[model samples]
Target: MKNSVKYAVTGALAGAANGFFGAGGGLFLVPLLAAWTKLEERKAFATSVAVILPLSAVSAIVYWFRGGLDFMTAWPYLIGGAIGGIIAGRVFQKVNMLWLRRVFGLLILYGGVRAVLLL
Candidate 1:
C-alpha cells in the first residue's frame, strides 16, 4: 500500500480507539507507526503525540456534546497534564529511547493488569 493509504488507515484506527476509549490512541498508534511504516521508534512516539492531540480534541468535543465529559472534574488533571507535557516535551529529545520504551511497556502492562483485575 502507498504510504498515504497506510497513514490514513492508521489514523482512522487511532481515531476510533481514542473516540472509544476516551484516550490511548497513542497506545495503538505508536506501535503501528513503528512497525507498519518502519518509522524510527522515537519519531513514531513523537508523531503519535502530534496526531493524538487533534484526535483527542475532537473526541473531547464529541464527549462534551454527548454529556459524557465533566469539565469541573477534569480541570485538575488538565492543569497537571499541561505541566507534565511541557516537561516531557522539553526533555524528550534527550531521553534514551530504550528506557522510554521500557517505561511505556511497563505502563501498558500495569494498565492491562489493572483492567483485567478490575473485571
Candidate 2:
C-alpha cells in the first residue's frame, strides 16, 4: 500500500481507539507506526504524541458537547499534565529508546491488568 493509505488507515484506527477509550491512541499509534511505516522507535514515539494531541483535543470537544466532561474535575489534572508534558518533551531526546520501550511495555501491562481486574 502507498504511504498515504498506510497513514490514513493507521490514523483511522488510532482515532477510533482514542474516541472509544477516551484515550490510548498512542498505544495503538506507536506500534502501528513502527510496524506499518517502518518508523524508528524514537520517531514513532514522537510522531504518536504529535498525532495524539489532535486526536485527544477532538475527543475532548466531543465529550464536552455531550456533557460527559467535567472541567471542574479535570482542571487539576490538566494543569499537572501540562507541566509533565513540558518536562517530558524537554527530556525526551535524552532518554534511551530501549528503556523507554521497556517502560512503555510495563505501563501497558499494568493498565491491562488493572482493566481486567476492574472488569
Candidate 3:
C-alpha cells in the first residue's frame, strides 16, 4: 500500500513535469525520491528512466494526434537517440558508481544553474 502510494505520487509528479519542462521529470523526481525514499542516486536515476517511458509515450501520442509530430525529421533523431541510449546504457555498466554519482550530481547542479541564469 505504501509502495503504491509512492509510485502514484511519483507518477503524477513525473507526468506533470514532463508536460511542462520539455525534458526530464528526473529534474524533480530524482531529488524528491532520493530525499523521500533515501534512494542512492544511481538507483534513483534508473527509477526515473523506468518511470519516464510510459509518460513519454503518452506525450508522444498527444503530439502525434495533434499533428505536431513530424516523422520525416523525427525518425532520424529517434534512431540516433535509440543508438546513443543503448550505448550509454552499456557504458553505464562499466562506470564506477561513486564517480557516476558525482558526475550526475554535477550535471543536475549545472543544469539548475544554467536554467536560473538563463531565466
Best by TM-score: 2
Evaluated at residue 41, the lDDT of candidate 3 is 72
Model 3, runs deviating above 4 Å: 32-41
**Which portions of model 2 miss their true places by more than 4 Å?**
none
| TM accuracy, model 3 | 0.76
Residue 92, candidate 1: how far off, in angstroms? 1.3
Judged by TM-score relative to the true structure, which candidate is superior, 1 or 2?
2
> Using TM-score as the measure, what is the rank order of every candidate, best first?
2, 1, 3
Per-prediction TM-score: 0.91, 0.92, 0.76
How far does residue 93 in candidate 3 sit from its true spot (Å)? Answer: 2.1
lDDT per residue, candidate 3, 5-109, as tens digits?
Answer: 886787788888776664668876777778778898778877888778788888777878988878798889889989998998889768898887788779878
Residue 10 alpha-carbon offset, candidate 1, angstroms: 1.2
lDDT of 2 by residue, 9-108 (tens): 8898899989998778888899989998899989999999999999989999999999999999999999999999999989999999989999999998
Clashing pairs in 2: none
